[model samples]
Target: MDDKELIHQILQSNNGIIEARQASEAGINNKTLQRLHQSGDLERIEHGIYIDPNYIEDIYYITQLRCKQGIFSHETALYFHELTNRTPFQLQLTIPSGYNTRLIKDKERFRFFYIKKDLFEIGKINMVSPFGNPIRIYDKERTICDVLKKKDQLDADLVSSAIKQYIKEPGNDFSKLLTYAELFKIKDIVRQYLEVII
Candidate 1:
């Protein structure tokens, strides 16, 4: 296919977002991206991330794409689970230990947690961000365990409030929370919080 057609097909499949590598795979090159930008067909959002000029961006999806192994965690996970009302200024991502994040040039925008590879995928689930981009995040149960594990770094009031909110939220499963607590080794802390709230 020609450059324009290849770009069009990619844009259509990816909700209007395109990456440089994707273009390369389709036989389009860096010069073509620059040409498309100059011609007003595409807008570059980051170093290698681009989108159709008309597309409304899902910024977190772009972030997730940048950190391929990142799973939304901590405050960001709380927001996804609706256990907290405050939006996190910096997104939190958890990646497995030994994964190099140096390749992500814009790493300051995220706070990362490194878990052992064996534990990295625990309670990982896919959910749409507020902007409607699908992302990997910890389930509510695992989020609770995470926050409890890192409570020292979080505001006491915020931690208390999030646990209270989760306790009241319909469809929350205490059994799942308990299970994750075992994996996270924060069962006593989680139990204490739940006992106080429930």
Candidate 2:
């Protein structure tokens, strides 16, 4: 296909956004991007990130995309899974222990947690953020296990409230919770919480 056709195909597949690197891989040069920008066909949103003029901005997706290793976790994951009523001021992100995080620009807006590489991907799921854009997050089960494991360090009332709300939600998965608890080495604490609620 020709340059314009190829660029159009790439933009269509990428939810109306594309990076300069992605464009280059597809043989769409920077000059072409500049031309498109000059002609009002595309807009530069973040450094090398560009979007079709019609594309809606999604801050969550942008943040996740910019920091590819960041997996939403802790309180942020709780909110994303709808297990908590309070919105977190800072986003919580977890990355594998050895993953380089220099790509993340705005460190102030996020709180980072580093987990062993072996367990980093456990219970990971793709869910839409509040802004309706795709983001990676730990599932409710993993999130519950995390909060339970760190209960002593977190707000006791909030932790209890999240667990109580999670238990009342339909389709809650105890088996998955148990499995994640075992994996996180917090089976005893999780069991204590479950026994009280179940």
Candidate 3:
């Protein structure tokens, strides 16, 4: 089948987001991408990424692009972990320190930050926002720890609420926090919340 037809199938399978590199695997070239765009078939989401413009929002595409092995993290993570009822106004994205994205047109709503790669490994899946933005939340232990790291922006009450909700869910991972806290030496703050809540 032709590139156009193949691309259609690939995007259809991916729920409308395709890696530009993946398309190249099917022998899609400049001419092919140009044709798709000219025909209004593909919309650029980020560098070397394309999505179906028809969809009001491309959740899978943007989520996959932002987190990767990185975690959704911080307050956003707490909400996703179901530890809070608050809906975040800004979407958070965490990457390994030094990770970068190409210039984006409307990045005002994105809050880009970084943590070590080892820190990112503890990230977990959270809910998607109404906009289809993935709120890739960090594990509870990790969320508390992150809050501690940014205590200036957070407080004991916020941390308390997150932990209280976390206990309500069967998703608590104390070991993950202890291990990370000890490894990073934030035990008293991030790891000690367990003592405060229970």
Candidate 4:
């Protein structure tokens, strides 16, 4: 297929979104992307990210694309897993301790939690964003452990509610939850909460 046809197919398959890197990997050069943008066939959403003009922007997907190392975590992850009903006022992201936060534009849009590199990938999982784009986030087990670790900075009601909601889910894994708590050195705290709830 021709480059334009390939681009059209990519956009169709990706829910009207495309990335410059993806186009480049598909053998379409930056000049072609620029030409498409100039012709109003594509809209630049962020550096290296583009979308069809009529498409609604997927903020979560775009954020991950811009900050590849950031993983949705804590309350944000809780929301994604339906462990809590409250929407986070500012999206929460977890990044490795040494990651360069300054490189992220609009830093105020996110609340970042930094962890050691070794622990960064623990319980990482992909979930579809509200816009139907796959985004990296912490699994429920890890998210609970993380919030428990940072309970002092969060609302007690929110924490309790999350634990309660998680307990109500049929697929909830106490073993995995405890294991993550142990890894995070919050096993006793997690157990105490579980004891009260269960």
Residue range 1-198, candidate 1, lDDT tens digits: 788888899998888999999999888877988889889899887788888988788778987887789999988998888788888887888889889765345555678888999989999999987666699999888888888898898777877898898899888889988988988888888888888777
Candidate 3: stretches off by over 4 Å: 66-70, 103-107, 117-137, 154-158
CA lDDT of each prediction against the hidden true structure? 0.85, 0.83, 0.67, 0.88
Shift of residue 68 alpha carbon in model 1, Å: 0.4
RMSD of 4: 1.9
How would you encode candidate 3's per-residue C-alpha lDDT over 118-194 as one tens digit per residue? 65666455656555555455666767677667767654676677767775667567777677788667888764566
lDDT of 2: 0.83
Q: How close is candidate 1 to the true structure, as a TM-score?
A: 0.87
Supply candidate 4's per-residue lDDT for 154: 74
Best-fitting candidate, scored by lDDT: 4
Give the candidate order by descending lDDT.
Answer: 4, 1, 2, 3
Quality of model 4 by C-alpha lDDT:
0.88
Candidate 2 local Cα displacement, residue 25, angstroms: 4.1
Score every model by TM-score. Answer: 0.87, 0.80, 0.77, 0.90
Candidate 4 to truth, TM? 0.90
Candidate 3 has its poorest 10 consecutive residues by lDDT at 101-110
- Deviation (Å) of 40 in candidate 1: 5.1
State the weakest 10-residue window (summed lDDT) of model 2.
Answer: 99-108
Error of 4 at 186 (Å): 0.9
Leading candidate by TM-score: 4
Q: Total clashing residue pairs per candidate?
A: 0, 0, 2, 0
